[model samples]
Target: MSSPNELPPAIFLDPWLTAEGDGLKALSQTIAERVERQISSNLSQSARRDAISRRGLVVENLVANLAIMHLSPHLENRDLLAVATAKTKATRYDREDYPKRLLSGVVLAMEELGLLIRHPYAFRERSTTVAPTPDFAATIDRQRVKLSDIGRALGAETIWLNARTGEISFADRTPLKCRIEYQDTEETILLRDQMERINAYLNQSGFRFDGEHQGPVCLRRMFLLRSLSDPHSFNLSGRLFGGWWQELRSDRRHRITIGGERITDLDFQGAFCQLMYVHLTGKPFPGDPYAIEGLEDHRGGAKLAMLTLLSRRGDLKRLSPELKAALPRGWTAKRLMDAFTRHHPALRDAIGKDYGVELMATESRIMVELLLTLKARGIGAMPLHDGVQCAASSGGLVAEAMQEVTERVLSVALPVVEKPVVGQEWGYKEAA
Candidate 1:
């Protein structure tokens, strides 16, 4: 293993280093070994060889261009593939499928050789334009690039790579740059600084530092602290409404007062809020309601909520016509719950009947409608389990419109706590 202090020498551009050259030779040998292994292990060797042959040709052509560029630090999308295919032909590997196989083999080798780094968060925006953010800068510095990161950054987690333009994208979002360049020493320093900055930022944000792992920072815990420290600001209908509600509930440390009733833990409250939101918006909740931490055994509540609003035969007889009209069409109480499970497969096993009773008893048509209207307007809706996710498009009118919707919904929900309690005193009280 290379020491932290040592840097790998630039062997690709070295001329004096013959076949015995350490870096280039090693890279070549590794590529060869990978191709050989792939060819040997393929279920049908003949078909594999044919495919590899064609792919190899393309790769050769591409490499030829790279040779011309002298393996320059960065290769744009078009140039990268072009050069690889050219190299294949120049090397007299004229198979039709050579380019495809060669490029795959090369990428695989580069990864194994540590020549290619994956970024954690690289993505394109909706404007068919790719703009590199501080996060991307940090990622390029880290010597790793994940294609998935590119998708997430653009808010389009599922994008297709364009074959014609060599463009990678999601939801009409295009990348600003196809690839980033990072040579040996540059990557290390960049990653170090980026991580340091991230840690510092987290600390400065008043977030209690917890241990770091391989995922998003423990913002949940930090948000919990923020909620506890400032109950008013963190109240369900206050500034910290919607998505933040789930985090408060999950940790079991946050509480809020609604009317004169002091809600001790936020679990049931969050679930209730989510159901109401779904009922209002006419959109399905993304996850199984039962999967929510404290609600696991109460799938029935979610089911009942779905039935009340979605089922035709549901007890909407008591609700105003305006409210009844908001229910899903052609749905029946019996099948409404099943539909929820079908639409969100991830929640299939988490809930059942007992939950239905709770939902029916506590159904709030007004609140549900309010949540749905906010959602239809593209405002962010925090369901019971999912964290805060942006529903609006990035930038411009769409984003602003959604923000407006969110503010309006918050205005109504937040005031519910301010009204004088009919039979009880208002304000926070200790749990009995």
Candidate 2:
């Protein structure tokens, strides 16, 4: 949306995609060489060579970094691929020292070459953003630069433990969450290898949105993401991310295609609570767990309440706007929390404690096992954490496979819910 005629939103960095691209690496090198040459008179030979040869500014790596940025807007809706450039700087993930030094130089060089227009990033909070200039957009069209030209970072460090937790800044200039870095262990490495295999299988699943045929498949690569709460533990809410379908609305996602075959949406019904219920009782939830007797109509509120009660740490202070809208008028989050506990006293001791990470960890294992099962049977699945997606024709089989995997992992078979395709009026709430 760097088009001069239309204003673009300020896109903050997303954790989903790294700013790395290998396409046009040679072309970028040529451009970087020219850029250094244009400034050659300003610095002597030794200084120029030293600057260019510095680790972060290595021409090829730096330009590929730019090329990914340049190519990103084309592959994804620019809004969907928000990567924090700050994290890229001085982090273990960016071991090469790329992006720390090369961003401005690449942007300026691209501007000079009329490849892009830049809105300077306010150093205070936002990362710099860019868009291809009209000429560059035209160039992209002419050369047909595309998704295959870009991908997950080359070395495939597909597992991450992020330390910077909160997003907002405090008035006194204190960061909301102190940043920390984590070291990897053998377990994390094993998860990374498993993810690489899954990614390899999924990347070939022929993913694309409806009505498009010419780009590389999406979510082909994924990473296991966890907060650095326990750097040594891979179990702290390790979720799989990096799928394009993840960015879609449910209705829109129904349009996804694998090898041009339309897909189906399936998930474990009420999975957050179901996982606990079944694991605790050794039985699937008896009925709609969110349907508290007095709050039968407040399923959403009940859901929000149960999630906060069981998953979040500490006290319930107030209702989020979404929760508030779902509850009875004048209900407090604390009131809802109390109501949830009163109805499900079995979970009383678990309230006010953090189980979100545990749930996700368990859910991650289930999803992985489900995907592997499907893979062994030559059926493809896209990991949706508590759910998965497969060709519509394969939905029943995927659902069955998922339940079997869940039963194996948790000793209870949580029901699989089939979400109908776009035209369907209603989806089945539980697998028959």
Candidate 3:
């Protein structure tokens, strides 16, 4: 609910950032020693020694995470690394690797050493946050950490379930992005194996976001599986998440490159609509799916209506103001729905239903097929919902590959729209 301008960026403390090379490992060791010495001098000797000794790895691991955050090209000094600690309810189902008890001590010790400024929970919803003090930055400065040797994020479990109702619910039940773990079955194993392979390729893909930072700004992209709506609802919405590029708007994402070359992005035109239509009717819709009477000039309205029609559950009821603005003036919600259904008669019986999850599952599988197909040829890409971002030189190949893979996945070749990085318009159609 809070706007981006309202709060400072909180880079979550990632426990997965381990010291990669021996040089960084030694640096973590050196930082851990300084923390231990400082804590030992201030606190009771036996208690500090025993407690710190018991969780040596935890202390260094915390140090490593903080170091990685600071060294990251994606971040500036003002963006603080927010950590969760000593809050039993907050971290109940969190992670076994980064125990709250051990981390709480490290946080306190670091604060005691004047290396961190701890912000107690501002509200019930937030974790206790911390920003490194000048002394801590000076410590990193003394170590001479470079961007090239900085990001070596070891891979971790990538398959996750998000039962947030929308990955939108921050309610206590699902809590913060509503991400929950799922029991992996044989089918899930297949999906996991597929995602793991994609992650592996991505780790080595050499893709960079090319942000304002002078150095390479790679965000350790490995596509993770996100099945939404329910953890128990296994086949519901299996979408690919975790690529940082997916977060960028098209204009900003124009800066992304694979191996320092300029980029090209290909989006499947009317992908999900095509998916649902072909899937339900066993044949593609004949005409332009967005074409309809009365709104011929406003294709944007027709498309948004089609989207809302598929995703909006329950009664048609009312249109949101944003939706209304897109549509013809003074048209009632029912009238717009009627017009849309009449135009695409095939989806008439399917209106007011929850096909959004089903469409995501269908689209994710289509993307997986395309991703794996490209990976096979050593062409790397970042998978969007119904499209992919790849090297500009590979644009033509990626477009063709997408056509072949979508045909195999959905039994119909969905149209693809090719977008060059420097282009003004949305995209040019590779095929219709």
Q: Which candidate is the best by TM-score?
A: 2
Global local distance difference test of model 3 = 0.68
Ranking by lDDT: 3, 2, 1
lDDT of 3 at 196: 74
Candidates 2 and 3, the one with greater lDDT: 3
Instruction: Give the Cα lDDT of each candidate.
Output: 0.30, 0.61, 0.68
Estimate, for each residue in 83-155, the C-alpha lDDT of model 2 and write its tens digit: 2334334665454534445445645665677765666545454455666566655554455545455434445
* TM-score for all models, in order of appearance: 0.22, 0.76, 0.75
Error of 2 at 238 (Å): 0.6
Please give, for residues 1-432, the per-residue lDDT of candidate 1 as tens digits: 323223222212111111222333333344445555544444486886666555443333322222322322222221111112123222211232233335545544434444333222113211111112334234333533221111001111111111113343442232222211222245334433433333333223221112111112211100111112232211121111112233332232122222212222111223443444443453334443435232244454444454444322223334333322444444343454454555555434334322332333233222333334434453432322211212122112322332343335433221111222233343431111
Model 2 clash pairs? 13-82, 13-83, 14-82, 14-83
- Model 2's TM-score against the true structure: 0.76
What does candidate 2 score in Cα RMSD to the true structure?
5.6
**209-302 per-residue lDDT for model 3 (tens digits):** 5632222222221222233432354566677765656666666666777867667778887776787788798877776788788998888888
Order the numbered candidates by TM-score, best leading. 2, 3, 1
Model 3, TM vs. native: 0.75
Error of 1 at 348 (Å): 22
